[model samples]
Target chain A: MPAICFIFLPIKYYYVRTHDEGVAVNKLNKFPKMLTRMRDGFLLNIGFAVLSIAIFLVIWYGLSIFLDTAYLPTPVEVWDALVDSFNTPDPSLGVTMWDSIMASLKRFVIGFVLALAIAVPIGLIMGFSKFAGMIGKPIVEVFRPIPPIAWVPFLFVVTGMIWGPILAIFIGVLFPVLSNVIFGVKSVEPQLIDAARTQGASKSDLFAKVVFPYTIPYMMTGIRIGLGIGWMCIVAAEMIGARGGGVGIYILTQANIGRYDYMFAGMVVIAALGLLTVEAASYVERRVSKWMGA
Target chain B: MNRSVLITIIVAVLLIGAGGAYVLLSSDDDGENKTYDVRVGYLAGDLHQVARVVASDDDVNGGESLFKENGLNISTPFAAGYANGGSVMDAFAADDIDIGFLGSPPAILKSLNLKIDIIIVAMVNSEGSSVVVKDGIDNFTDLKGKTIATPGVSSIQHLFLLELAAANGMNVKLDGTDGDDDTVFYVQVAPKDMQAAMDTNQVQAAIAWEPYGSQMILSGAGELLLWSGDVWPDHPCCVIAVSRSFAETNPDTVEMFLKAFIQANEMIDGAFDAGSGETYDRIITLATEFSGTNETVVLSSMEHMDLDYQIGDNFETYLEDYTQSYIDLGLIPGSKLADRDYANVTEYVEDLVQVQYLEAVD
Candidate 1:
């Protein structure tokens, strides 16, 4: 028991020393680091963003005046529309702006999550094994270049209107996630694999511990990209194929009826939803990959 | 800078300079030869054959030279073709189009929304729309629980479908759900793709304006479940709509344009009355040329449509009823000036139909 303690004590001491150094350094850096972050982080960036948006609004207002067409509804008019849409339901569309946004978000989440579930495993298999990669390469290469809208008719025929847009979005998101996961797996450090093997780690254990951790940052990147593409795809698919209520459908329907103000409001809602989702994805990445020091 | 970079910069500058010179010279030419540009929006279907004949200078009645004869130096009219009435209304709102030949519901919707202040100039065609279904589906009740496609929610055909369903006591569900046992699911499809959707069994029935409905019947993809005229006899389908701004700014031009269109409509009527031979052949040729459809489809579609240019009392009643249907559907607000009620809605519809131009032409 003493001998065992002696052996374990050195290892424990080494860990403690490294951990203490890390903690001390973090403590020493915290104040200046926070100051630097404050100089460049949320408040400052938000201020700049607000300024940028103000400039955009000014330009838009100027153009609206210059054009003087009903199509170019002013910011004030759009605001009125946005307010009205939120307050009262559009009888034609059968829903308020809030309902449309919620419906769109629900479809987006289902499609995005479905894409991730299917793509991640296939990407992992392709990345970790040469045989799988060889088989998947041609299939991915072929389908990756096809635009999501091209699948609308086929999806509509098979799944009907309700699921067609979601499936279209899933297809749009799948390729980006798959490609990035494959890249992350293929780019895993050779030395790390050798080290794990030298320590008598099994193939499954190496994949579970090393490959997964290494691939997570890349997977997050893929997810971020997939999410953007998925948002665009959801809008287009819904515009073309959705029979029910969605933000894209609302925009299209409004435009069809010459309600440009409502169309612009719907567009603003889509942009805000997209920005929030991307930020959510980034937040998840930061939380999950904190050990990578991102 | 490196020699290669310097060379590249010089080449880029020369290219941009050449392109700029070309654009400047071309714009100067355009400015010098500026003709009265009347951008007209019309549907890509046989309903707008009169407008097409006037624009294309192939009027069988020899009305092509009428623009110059009226002291208007109009060039070949710019045709802004759209797939449906809704898009034509959109173009009118955007000021991309000054005149439109579109369906009644979209025209009325736009006027009610104050999107485009348009005057209903003339009737383009009537009774050209139909509800077509797969061969085995015989009646409106048989369409229950089956999917049906229409051009849009605010389309005249859609309104017709709703009325038909209501008459037959069938529930029409627009929500994206599969309808219940007594409900018919309604999907909005572009008129161009309605036949394809029907062919693929994606939709059991399609309610669309001609020549799509006619095309479906000609192709044997579907049979006519009900003609719109059979539902509402001589129901107003398409109307000639002119921007109020255009009419106010250029009343003579609008009058001249309407005169030419009315003449073409007369020619079409004369040919239909004659019913065969050279006059009818010429009308079919003009329609086929403008609509980008084949001759057989054009001929068959014309059989279902009455190319009447007059907007009579029947038109006013039709417009009022249609406006009330849209108001009840919660499509357009009930009224712009008063409370959301039938009287107010009728008042609003009255304001929308400006028939002084049509009357003056008459």
Candidate 2:
């Protein structure tokens, strides 16, 4: 069977097997209608995305012609440059475009995953305990406003070039994820927790069952925002200094050498990576939401 | 949409359209006899003292007044600064400034890339830079697998480092990463922070221009591994460059500017020749004032540098060698050499060096 049909078959079998005789007929009929609505929605979204991208390209092409400078390369030139970079290692930088992208992605993922791992647990504790909240709140507020670029020099001194950029990204993503996760935990309905406690649930059970599921959506929201911040931080951090070739370093080296087309190509790759990762995060969010029926 | 909102949007669009049109139209005002603000950039190093002396309007010690005396109405100068030559060219590429006092490597690289149409007008100074390493690291061979910092990848000091490494048969890598254990690593640290990086043991050594290198030695943070002059005697370091458009439009003004620069160079030479009097004191004072460095550092750095006032035969040789070094380092395309042999590279280097203004000055 086709994949789409296979997906629907399980739903049909489960409802048909579980529902009462009268409800079974109604549910079986409703499933196809719901599936049709979902397919249409997916198509409509794809259509809008394509239309928006086409408009953006048209505007970019118009501007490039109007500017008429080497600095402002046309879309076609940038595309050619992108293709050329992917195919060949730029002799000046000693790395291909794919290598640069992979290097940047590695740093971004490591830093972001590390930030999420540390921030979520601290946020949970801060939300659950008043003493923890009081102690952590001031530190976060004080450090959060300082820009990530400012930390480059200090981090370079402490971590060296290889790990400095990674740590800088981690610092950039930490606060937003932490604060939002705290907000997620605090916003959990108190009545739900009280009810769980009344049902003979222990503290750990109440947290696992009641608090955790309620906070997952908010935690996802934090991760989404943190991912964006981490991307921005990695670029700036790499520009300050990098040992291996990264997208940011590649763009900067190209700019310094007056290869504006390749610079733009690097920028496009970074944007694409950012979009791809955010889409992946959204996919995970949707799967979890479905599991929780949220 | 509502009628009021529609009208407001139309007005905003018209305003933005008009503003952009004005910018586009006004850019053409750089015609004959049209005076525009002159933005001059200089590195924050002692090598740029000649340009600094010329740009300043301080009556007691300013080069702007001297230019004014020669009937060149140089509008009050706009000063742009960078820590090193690499960033100076970056500013030029961005159109942040029209003229720069920067090192030869960056100037050559910028012209090769055609980012800015620039002509080297005059030589600044030479032999002022050095390679300094932490104490107990006695020689270039000791730097294997150790980290060293320079102003930037394309700065002349970086070229000097690479040339030295190549001479010693040492493998050098520009990226500051964990590479082969036998390779040396180089990172870009701004000149101002080179001392700090050395002091904090962030880098075991640094190749930098004065007075940062001098500061490091004075503070006991490092010892001189090699003088730049020891590698290439009287090698060209910083040169004054002007955008080709600026030179074309304001030929007479540029000539006058070069005349003033030559005069300042002469004055510096005369002071150093006197070797210990009011004249030397004045040069040191002016250098300290412009460089924002202490008097002792400036004095010590001056001892190491020879300020060349003229564009000489050696400049062509230096330019060719530097360009070849760039090609060898893979910072520029080797195809620049594919069509040409050594003589052609010399001719190409000569094409970039416009000496008419400097020659016309005398």
Candidate 3:
């Protein structure tokens, strides 16, 4: 995928031809009006998102007030809790919400990078070789259906650390990348390979120049999808040992202690974190695809 | 143009998200675990009668007046009830109780996890615990290579068996294996299916506290192996633990609680004359209030009267023994605390108990 990304990306740029080259001239001609239009669009989205948040908070508050039993503390009570949590001079141990977030992120990144490292090469090998495909296909099929959580104990027993949960994320992500790499490799036009051969390119060169280029986008797509799934698996992964202070642990601990407020808080934090991750991933996808002219 | 700026933005967002998550995950709450207007957990069979009595009693500080002060609708006591000590322990861990009654084993296990701060306000009863074994197994060692059923891995019954095994040089593995030839099979099974487990020869013996133990004995299915209290005399069977901060912030309220409990204990022990009209009414009311037995049956249930309501001074001995058993079982770290620390449990207990409360009531 990396070779293909290096190869086809140039081909994409050759056709791209600087679509935005005339932007400065166009901006000068209608700069004020165009800027205002873009500004309006941004403001409109901001308003809609704000309204959506306000509506959610109102509904949540109403439900909480109507169910003012301790089992269902009102949003006001939760808000007060949130405020009280911050008001203390030094946020005590376990009160470190930032620490939990960083821990989860660190685990997620390590698992993600490790998955990519293992999956991409295996995927490339399986895509190009019949023997690799035949041997790997059955194994992938058998393990893919076994949920990431099933690997948690295996990971724990092996690493004797919190890495078990992280490994679960890696395993979950690997299958998607494997399947996508195979699809991407197969999708490379055979004529391009033949052309490369006719042009005195070596077998390796043909593969490097023609096949690799077509597969890069597919591998990227797989990565995006796999990472989404990996994040979901992280919570199950963090359940293995005592040092497990991930977002999932946070939620479960609150649920166990019947602290619904903290549980809700943890859940909300996860959602927000997920949104931020997706946004960053989307930005990278857009930038990469644009640079590749794909 | 500015990659560092983008990186900074990403890092900042991540830190904020991470910070929120850490606070959500790590917030240590040792106090204010009271999540309900009235979080009340007790024996399932006893709740209805107790609710009626509390609904009627005006003298008890947080009984009837508690409901009134909280403006709780008195249509029915919304108290949740469970049949087993394990479930109550789970509920307690979940903060599903402002106050609840839990068996000694669950309470002891809970004490290991420092944040819980469960204080035994009073001893509920002692003789209700019994272990039953197969009819042919005349002695404890006779049931080698056979499985014994327990409700949970850490129930009082379960721990009693563990304590017994440790004393007798047996390894209580999860699968009920003793490395040597002599083995007593011990495994956890759901409480409801215990009788069936026994009947079908799935389990060779069962260690259960009443009313399951008493009920099993009555059925003539098994012979008694040992009463758990006899395993460790005056072992503080079932206990009533209130939140430490609840006791601290509301000391007078706690004292009032002790008064009510002591009065009930005195009445149940028959120290007060039930023949007197006032005493008889209170007795009938209490029998109706706490146990939910019919006034006649509840009064009769107290016939084998040994209400040892005193909280023993041998706190260190129980803690050391209990913590050591957990350590030996590999349930907790052996080096978690020292002898002095166990002796001065008052670090946690002082926040929960005002011995003066019990003494004053006495």
Models ranked on DockQ: 1, 2, 3
Question: Model 2: DockQ against the native?
Answer: 0.27
- Candidate 2 structure quality by residue, lDDT tens digits, B186-259: 87777777777788787899988888788788888899898899989989998888888888898877877777
Q: Over the stretch B157-224, how does candidate 1's per-residue lDDT look in tens digits?
A: 88888898889888787556445688888777877777777887878999887778888988988998
Which portions of model 1 show Cα errors greater than 4 Å?
Answer: A1-37, A40-89, A96-106, A125-146, A150-159, A200-208, B1-36, B46-80, B135-137, B141-145, B166-171, B177-182, B270-294, B338-362
What docking tier does model 1 reach? acceptable
Interface RMSD of each: 2.7, 2.9, 12.7
Model 2 alpha-carbon miss at residue B1, Å: 42
Instruction: Give lDDT per model, in order.
Output: 0.78, 0.77, 0.59
Task: Quote model 1's TM-score.
Answer: 0.78
Candidate with more favorable, higher lDDT: 1 or 3: 1
As for candidate 2, its clashing pairs are: none
Q: Per-candidate DockQ versus the true complex?
A: 0.29, 0.27, 0.02
Better of 1 and 2 by lDDT: 1
Model 3: per-residue Cα lDDT over A1-294, one tens digit each:
343333344445433434556545544446445435644775545555676676777898887778543445566666665454344311111234565676688888888899989988888888887899999889988987887878776665555334666788888788888789988887878787778888999878876777777778788888878877887888776544313256665555444333456556666777777777767777787777887787
Tell me the spans in candidate 2 whose CA falls farther than 4 Å from its real position: A1-40, A58-66, A84-87, B1-37, B45-47, B54-80, B83-87, B90-96, B176-182, B271-286, B289-292, B328-330, B334-343
Per-residue alpha-carbon lDDT of candidate 3 for residues B1-362, written as tens digits (9 for 90 to 100): 59999999999999999999998777544343321233556655432123223432554433344344333322223354565554565566566665566665555544553235556676666545567887888767776666777765556667788777767766454331223556465554544445555665556788865545544555665777877766677665666666665666665555555555555555434533546565456546655545443555444334322355567765435645655565565444333334225543334344333355567556
Angstrom error at residue B222, model 2: 1.8
Tell me how far the alpha carbon of residue B336 in candidate 1 is from the true structure, in angstroms, after superposition.
1.9
